[model samples]
Target: MSRYETVIGLEVHAQLKTKTKIFCSCSTEFGKDPNENVCAVCSGMPGVLPVLNEKVAEYATKMGIATNCEINLKSVFARKNYFYPDLPKGYQISQFELPICEHGHVDIEVDDEKKRIGVTRIHMEEDAGKSIHSAADNASFVDLNRTGVPLIEIVSEPDMRSAEEAIAYLKEVRSVLLYLGICDGNMEEGSFRCDANISVRPYGQEEFGTRAELKNLNSFKHILKAIKYEVDRQIDLVEDGEKVVQETRLFNVDKGITQSMRGKEEAHDYRYFPDPDLVPLVLDEAWVKQWQSELPELPRDKRERFMVEYTLADYDAALITTDRTVAEYFEAAVKAYNGEAKKVTNWVVGELLPFCHEVESEACDVKLSPEKLAALLTLVDDGTISVKIGKDIFRDLCESGDDPAEYVKAKGLAQMSDSGELEAMVDQVIADNPSEVEAFKGGKKKLMSFFMGQVMRLSKGQANPGIVTKMIQEKLS
Candidate 1:
């Protein structure tokens, strides 16, 4: 049997987070009643003129600049003719030949290797209305609220070799969009959706095999599964002497398989023509430079900075910079601690992160400020509080945002690091646990742990365990 390789490309439609619809004055709010947000312009009523939204163009330009794409100085919208009841317009206004961006690429890290995936084009388009189908009643309902919502469809070249690379590309693209604030990148609410074109070919073969388009993949997990299943299905079909047909398929997440929707249509099938209602969008180099200057330090740059400046490991840098809020929080904490990178990372990852997840709050909104957290860690470092006591105080600070120093003083949780005091405590503990002491003398070194625990309990968890253990070892010997 010959081994086959899978090749995949993705068309990611990310709904721009604008306040109003693309070509209308209606609110672009999601979750509204069906057709409530629709207007004559979005509904595709005859004689309705579609005025272009300037923000949409700015966002598209921003994405183009961010992805290192060639921004088309002039881009035009073309009507994509189709007859779907959900699309109030008999034709969807989309860009075909002259898209806003072309020949861009984003670098993605998959399995510790960096790969650049080529972006064929990023075009501006208006979304079609959603159709909800009922399984039991076999009826479909239309929601036009999403119709006319602005979107930038980022089409990637078929450069991905596996499902993992495809997912990494999707994640990097989504992260860039989110950081740019052009799109919210929420997959669940249809704000960000992906359609994958996947095919399988024999290893070392140059010609591409038959490809299937998988739609309705809302989440990253589903995209991976759907692509893998489709690849396997196509490879199996070729192995069984059956040809893989070119068709659009829907991924049934519940069933974990792709079902055929319709045969693929060529681009000319849509009868594309310039939209008469909308004029060509002419962007000057000055405007593109403005949006480019406003772009934030993207994920890759921030990740590298964290590693170099803060001495964070790759995983730590990656985690801290995954979201803007988390990244800012980590940076602020580091600044407060005078560049105690490891301590800041430990507190943020170990304590602040779990607390944020538990309370369903953002890390930026956590009660403890980075300054206070740094101060708390300083207390542990200076032996003002033991590590265990510092943890307790840190939890209190997280709950109340209290000053760590004040809390430690009020709670009497300061560490008893004075050698005289800790030594006396350890001696008392050994005298009290005579039998355990005998076990230690008889080579049951594990009893040392018991002695330390007793000392910690006696000190109310304020004794420095390191000092206590050393003193106990000297006394026993």
Candidate 2:
């Protein structure tokens, strides 16, 4: 028996975030009435000449520069001939021989090791329409609304050895697209979709094995599972003296199985040819350089900077920089209040994150602005309010966007930080919890927590816990 290794490559199709469909004037909005966003060009009516969307080219160029790809000076669109009810044009206008980008790479961290995955090509293409299958009956319907929408298919080399690597690569790519504002990167809305090509071969084998293309893996978790299952399935076939067949398979997320869609179509199967209707795209050095300047700091660089500048750990930086909105929010909070890194991080990660999810909003729309959060943290730091009381005021600020210090004073929620006031409260707590006081005297110093709890309850959670604890220890001693 020969040992085997799994090899996987990914082909990710990301829809560019443009206002209108490529080559047409149709609105590129999702969830419109079926075909409501379609127009004559997108619907493939007769006698319409396809006009190129300039923004698509700019987006492609931006992605190419970001991924370290070579921008093709001239790229051509070709006719991918296929017949499907959803595709009104009967052929998708896409780049085949000459794509907008080539030979790029993205570095992904897997198992604490950074591995570079090679990007074979990134090509521009028009999307096909969507097909809707009815649950009530054995009926299927087609919607041409998405037809002629612009997409860039990023093809990666077979450089991944495990499912983790594949998912990391996918996440990194999605983050790049989102950071660039080129794609919304929504998997559920079909804005960013991924199809994987996977195979298994003996360890150190030079030749590759038969590969299966898996599609409809919408989420990151599903992608990981699908790749793992496919790898196992292929290895099992080889072990049982069977050969893995080359085919296109669809992942049934609910069933957790891959079903064959069709025999895998080779490149020649589509009979690719330069589209006669549209002219070749020509990009100059000046044009490419202009788009390059617009590129922001990508995920890797941003993550490192966050770690260095804010003294955050790798996980914290990764979480903060995963989305552009979160990163901006964090930076704003840091700027608003000087040298309160940990406080800002706690509120952003703990309170703001859950609040965003609760209201079903992106981080960009977080009701508690970074300046406001910083102000709240400052209130706690300056002893204007206890940490517990600050949290309550912060929640009110999140709801009403009011000033934290003013809210605390107006609501009489300020901490009893005066030594005289807290001393009296500490005495009451010590008298009430005699067992805890005895325990503390007997060297079970952890009973300090019990005394602290009683103090908090007596103060109605308005006492400064640090002051109360210190005053209690002094009085008890």
- Which ranges in model 2 have alpha carbons more than 4 Å from their true place? 392-395
Query: What is residue 353's positional error in candidate 2, in angstroms?
Result: 2.8
Model 2, range 1-477, lDDT digits (tens) per residue? Answer: 438888999999999999998898889988889889988888889999999989999999999988989999999999998889898888899999999999999999976899999999999999999899998988999988888889999999999989999998999999999999999999988888899999998888899999999986789988988888888888889989998999999888888778889999998988999999998999988999899998999999999998889999887788788888989999999999975587788878877777776876787775678888888888888887877777666666787878777778788888887888888888887788788788788899888888888888888888888888778788778
Against the true structure, what is each candidate's TM-score?
Answer: 0.91, 0.95
Cα error of candidate 1 at position 438, Å: 4.1
Instruction: Compute the lDDT of residue 343 as modeled in candidate 1.
Output: 86
Clashing pairs in 1: none
User: Looking at model 1, which ten-residue stretch has the lowest summed lDDT?
Assistant: 387-396
The 10-residue segment with the lowest total lDDT in model 2: 387-396
Q: Whole-model Cα lDDT per candidate? A: 0.88, 0.88
Assess the local accuracy of residue 34 in candidate 2 as a C-alpha lDDT between 0 and 100: 88
